[model samples]
Target: MAASIGSLLAEISGVEDPIEELQSLKTALLSIPVSALRDSVSGQRFDVIFSLLDSNEREQVELCVDILERILMALSPVNVVQNYRVELQGGLTHPKETVKILALMQIGRVVEHPDAVTEILNNHDILRGVIHCIGEEMSVAKQAVQSLSKLSHSKPGLDKLFQSDLLNAIKDVMATSDIIRYRIYELLVEISSVSPISLGYCANSSLISQLLSELTGDDILIRATAIEMVTALAHSPHGRQHLSQQGIMDKLSNMIRGAETDPLSSLYLPGLVKFFGNLAIMESPQQVCETYPAFLDKVFEMALDPDPAMIGVALDTLGLLGSTVEGKQILQKTGKKFKAVLLRMSKHGSLGATNLRVRSLDAISQLLTLLPEQQTEDLLALTESWFQLLSNEPMDMIRNIITQPFPELHCSALRIFTAIADQPWGQKLMMSTPGFMEFILDRSTGQTKEAKDGKFQLVGTLAGSSTAAEILGSQHYLRMKTYLREGPYHVTAVATVSTEGAD
Candidate 1:
């Protein structure tokens, strides 16, 4: 190992330019796992790394930092802490954001144990490094916050988190930027969600009250941001109970009720809609919609609006809402609103802005999709009803869709077909529709890798289902089974033997 480093240095010494030499070293070192390349690391390796770091060249310093993280990742946490504890601690406060994340991940991996938590508790530098990470970069901030939350799983760990040092650190960051402030709030909410005792610990700070109140703040954008953190808070029973007592409804009421009844006149907030929509899917879909009736009203209104942005958000929200069975049930209860949304979806699904068209197909697929186990007689009837009503010319429209030059649309439409391929009613429709079965059997139709996979998924779904054989008629079903056997991109191999005049 020493000889290898020696040879590397000897080779780079003759290079004409310093930066080129450093870059060459970096490239060579990266190609080899220098940290894990040997069974035992030599002290010369550390010396060479420190020498490079001290050179103060930006490229060399950056490479050293990255290499440190590479070493940290390659080693076990215990080995890292035991052998490179000083450098590991230095890495936690590294200027490069990715190194900070890698260092925090190392700590987070081991700190799940009580002893590890206690050990980290005593090391104030490591603790401060982790907290500083909370304000560094968005991705690192999340890692730091999550690492700190793991400490709260124990009493002493809880003390460390709620202590003046950590609180002061977070308080300092809260003063920097609104985004960083919310990062701190997000951490508190996470700790609070652990248990009732943890929630009580977080309550000692004024941040909790500030967070809940901001959920109803005058600025809608900030309110939406607050709701993102608070949504996680709602996952816990105590957290939900706290939100209820704190008047969560008061925070959301006005947002649901747009400024005007007229769809065009109303304020359109994609994030605001997503907040309520996601909460509904995660919690009680029916109850969330019922408590905030205007939530769906806005979604429907947005779907009907002419603005492409509104339509895009509406498509995304609808896709999310219709993904689960409970979500489907809630949509079903919307009656004509559901039908109107489906109607709008078909307009986009068949032809519109590229993204909206893709989203419409995805949403319809999600709405129609059901697992084999979840399919009851009622559920099958629901899916059939959904397919039959996507548009007035639902059958012919989709049939024409597959023939288009757009591969994305072709794939999305194929996904919709994949979603329904297992159901009895969907099979009946395919059987009755002329040339649909031929499209299913024809592998030549899929133009791209994604489209090929999509078509194969539909064929696989049909070939694997119990009822497809009987309902699709044994002959058509047999071809589908053959398609599945050959796989998505299969082409028949042809061989030819050519003979010259001599032969």
Candidate 2:
């Protein structure tokens, strides 16, 4: 059967085969096992299939299309892709667009097989067809890109894929159409996520410039996708440099301004903010500080908006921005105006001096930390008035500070409290804060153990403690027991630090 098919291919190449011969060859190609199709003797047989698949003759082309469909449905079995190179090119350029599309689709479906991927890389014209389909129509183009993702899967192969100029083709598709751009952006992200080094190739291409242009696009989804891709690019040291060179800061700042209240804008804001925050290199900390006040204004505006979650996010970012050195320098330049706004905000009841107020308070705390010691004095004085508010705040509120999105704040605040407890003057300020000590005591309770001798083996990791055995020493246990019975707060919440948690 294979020999007959080979004969038919040679005969058909003459353009003089009887129609019946073409028909029989098509049936045989359809019946041949994909594994057998990879056999040495099957080369000529595949050539025949490719010939008919590429034929300009109407019936021959249709038959070839159906056979290609069958082979693809068979999972392009056995990777019989090598010897069919010329034939594959023929299908890629078939006169009918639908046939050309199907050929590319078939190639994509099987392209996961190493040999088939190699075949794709080897035939530049066929690879071009795949990219063309990606640029031609949204659905078809997306499908074409989906195939490119497979070629970029394995580590070495991703490097090879880039070497083949396929990565550049993907970048070209992104440059051409929104749908193509969307698919290509996501695929590049997946590839980069797997092998960050591949991003260098993407960076060298026009990917950053094109994506930056899309930042200003009217389509929110397009803009969001572009930002996501930018986030991936900014994740790597190499990619971040490319982004800086692309003038991403100015463009992103503009996005923050225009989209502040658009409702759809914040969808991309956190990630964009995080990415900008994470970039290892920036044009200048001063330049960033110059632009950041505009961002802070938007953030403060969002905080005052009706949305509670948005308010929290805004407060959090304000806190993040304020914690930075440049942000502090910027805050310093603003001087008394900044201090005044903070004082006024502290007195404002909308933040309510409640747990819901923690986000705001935490932001204030970060701002205070960012200030110089002398500069923080005024804020510390303001805190004396809100001291009762903190004193009355729920254990859950304190627990949340230690437990929530930024556990570092909770830890920092607690450590400060611990330090204050150790000072004569500071201890007076915190003397009435019974729950705070009990909170630390609860966290330390896990260290206690019952010895085989029926006594306690106390284990502890207290800061500045000389030894674990010294913790809850006989005298201390009595003190702890008395404190537990008459404790200001009877219950405490212990937090586990996971990556999703404190860590």
User: Which structure among the candidates has the greatest TM-score?
Assistant: 1
Query: What is the per-residue lDDT of model 1 for residues 151-229, given as tens digits with 9 covering 90 to 100?
Result: 7788887788776587777788788888888888888888999898999888877788888777656766676678777
Clashing pairs in 1: none
Residue 344 in candidate 1, Cα distance off native in Å: 1.3
Per-model TM-score, in order, reads 0.82, 0.47
What is the Cα root-mean-square deviation between model 1 and the actual structure?
A: 4.5
- What is residue 164's positional error in candidate 1, in angstroms? 3.5
* lDDT of predicted model 2: 0.54
Prediction 2 TM-score vs. true: 0.47
Clashing pairs in 2: 134-141
Candidate 2, 1-503: lDDT as tens digits:
65765676676667664466667666776677766654424333444555555446777667766665654454442344554455555655556765766766667655677655665666667776766676665555566667666666755556555666666666676677566667666666655554446666555555645667887788877777777778776665556665667788677877777775687876776655555544412333456555554555555555556665556666666566665556555555665655544544443323353443656665655554422233345444433333334434523444444444343344434433332232222334333445543455543422222111111111111222232114324454454454445433334567986675543
Worst 10 residues of 2 by lDDT: 450-459
Q: What root-mean-square deviation over C-alphas does model 2 reach? A: 13.7
